[model samples]
Target: MLASASASKAACNQETLNTTSFNYVNDIENQTVHDIAVKFNRGVCDIGRANLMVDVSVVPNVGQTIIIPGQVCHPDWTTCVIDGPGTNDCLIGGPRLYYTLNGDTMWKIAGRLNMTLDAVTCGGDSCNTNITCIDGICPGGGGSQYTANETIPAGQFIKIPITCDIEPYTFSAGVYKDLAEKYGSTVGQIQMLSPTYNYSYIANEGGTFPPIALAKNCRLLSSNYTILS
Candidate 1:
């Protein structure tokens, strides 16, 4: 009986060892499976890398819209509060060059600028019509008419016709002569039309009054002549 009892105790000890070994293997397998699942989840959510790029040079002028790429962070870095290029709108208005004339006819301004009437009026109404006549009738004239030039307010602004010449760039009697010759006008007529220009010569440049003939040839590039009150 004693031998049989000892054998039974040994068999029970063996059974316990077997159960512990199986449990250890199962625990290790479960841990490995958990680690793999965690890694798979991270991979699935990862955004990886972005190959997109923004080219600022391609942006169009203002008032025009453009489509920009979207990223994990806002792709419009220019507009973003953070990580933005900088403040102020990136797009800008188109190029605009304008000139104001004080005379009524295109021919007058053309003569002033030393340009042909056709050249100055090439753009039609906007180039040739007066600012007042843009919407309302011109004062002192009939038929809802607009002047071909801007109505400069007295003492508000001065409009002068300037000419770009190759030699004697400064305003002088010789320059005036060149202008008159080019524009088919008399020196006296030019002097009468632009008396302010003559005054500017005495006041600003401190030069003696030039000959009326040379003054006629002078081409206007800029003028210091101001409107009178």
Candidate 2:
């Protein structure tokens, strides 16, 4: 419920974009933050240009008290992953769920949000969403089955697997050792999904990895960190 900005700056704040999106409570002239970023598909991240009372003529009158930023789509939009610039895999929007607090893991919570590690350990079929069954002998009710290096505790909700319009490739500097010898995969297996950029800092900032069959859905963590970097 609180730990959103710790894990080494949340593995690089991957588009929870300083997190928040309540999804309701309109007042900006009866709801005008692009109608709360289209009801809640979110993208407004927020930036009043400079605020000379601009945008929708500077809303906040009808009721006054605008803040909304606590919701981001994921009741299961058919368990997204519309790769290849199609439009579905959160990228920087949301496949949102996020709950865990105390030093949350899962590859720094899917490397903040740039997602990888088999899409947060849910992999191809995309996991999470058990619901805990207990009486039924706990199946979906108990949820949080997790695997890949497991740990994730806090409140444990996590289910972010987004993928809209594909965008995650960074292999600069002599081109990631020649794309790891043409996708045979090495260079520490492409830095196990690039936990925080490497390969000479993504070729001195030019960046462009994710190629070998979508970087082979990485997520190779073992030396976790939530801060104290």
Candidate 3:
């Protein structure tokens, strides 16, 4: 797995976003958007929005055509880090659209993204208005937005407020401080990812540590990026 990951990274480096164009493929194996993104070393949201998928996480029908966009790294892959408001933890390049799946709610979605409900909703910035509704029927308009937590019906694509991209990692044998130092993260940030853990206690052998988002270059997104930045 390590060898394959390295090769994929090498392949990704060879392809630049400026020179690469859209690549088309057929879902003969019945793959999801995530699967295609991993196979092509692109971001899931990139392929999802490019194909205008109502549910980015859903698997495409067999033989359906999918469009893969050119991206330098997976949306969750952080390239570099910059000084930020909190602890200088790594943040994603920009916010990515999260399409609601069945049984999705505000609290559940926030937890999956490892974000506080308040941060997910309006972390220091006002809520974004550019929502793309599925089924061609928008809920609210004319200065009134549908907003979060109201039914949160499936197939709705909402812009996730920009936050750090978290990757799950298991600690070999160390306390929170050791893991944080190894990953260039802070203890407070690590605790946020796995709040139940006792940071001071040494982790049990083979016990998996909480997920962490490594630092990366965070080029703030402008207001006008159509799908993703």
Top TM-score: which candidate number?
3
- Residue-level lDDT of model 1, residues 1-229, one tens digit each, is 2332243344233333312100011223113211321332211011111101011111112232211111121111121011112111100110011132222243333343333333333322322221212232121112112234433322222222222222222333223333445554432234334343321213123444433212323323333221111
If both were scored by TM-score, which would come out higher, candidate 1 or candidate 2?
Answer: 1
TM-score of each: 0.21, 0.19, 0.28
Cand. 3 Cα-lDDT: 0.41
Whole-model lDDT per candidate: 0.25, 0.33, 0.41
lDDT score of model 1?
A: 0.25
Model 3 misses residue 153 by how many Å?
19
lDDT of 2: 0.33
Q: What is the C-alpha lDDT profile of model 3 across 1-229, one tens digit per residue?
A: 2333454465344355543645455545545555676677665555554443332434465656565555554343221111122311112332345555544454444443434454444433222344333333221111123334544665665554243446666443433334444655443344344433322111222234434333223343454333221
| Segments in model 3 whose C-alpha atoms lie over 4 Å from true places | 1-19, 74-229
Worst 10 residues of 2 by lDDT: 47-56
Q: Candidate 1 at 161: error in angstroms?
A: 14
Clashes of each: 16, 36, 4
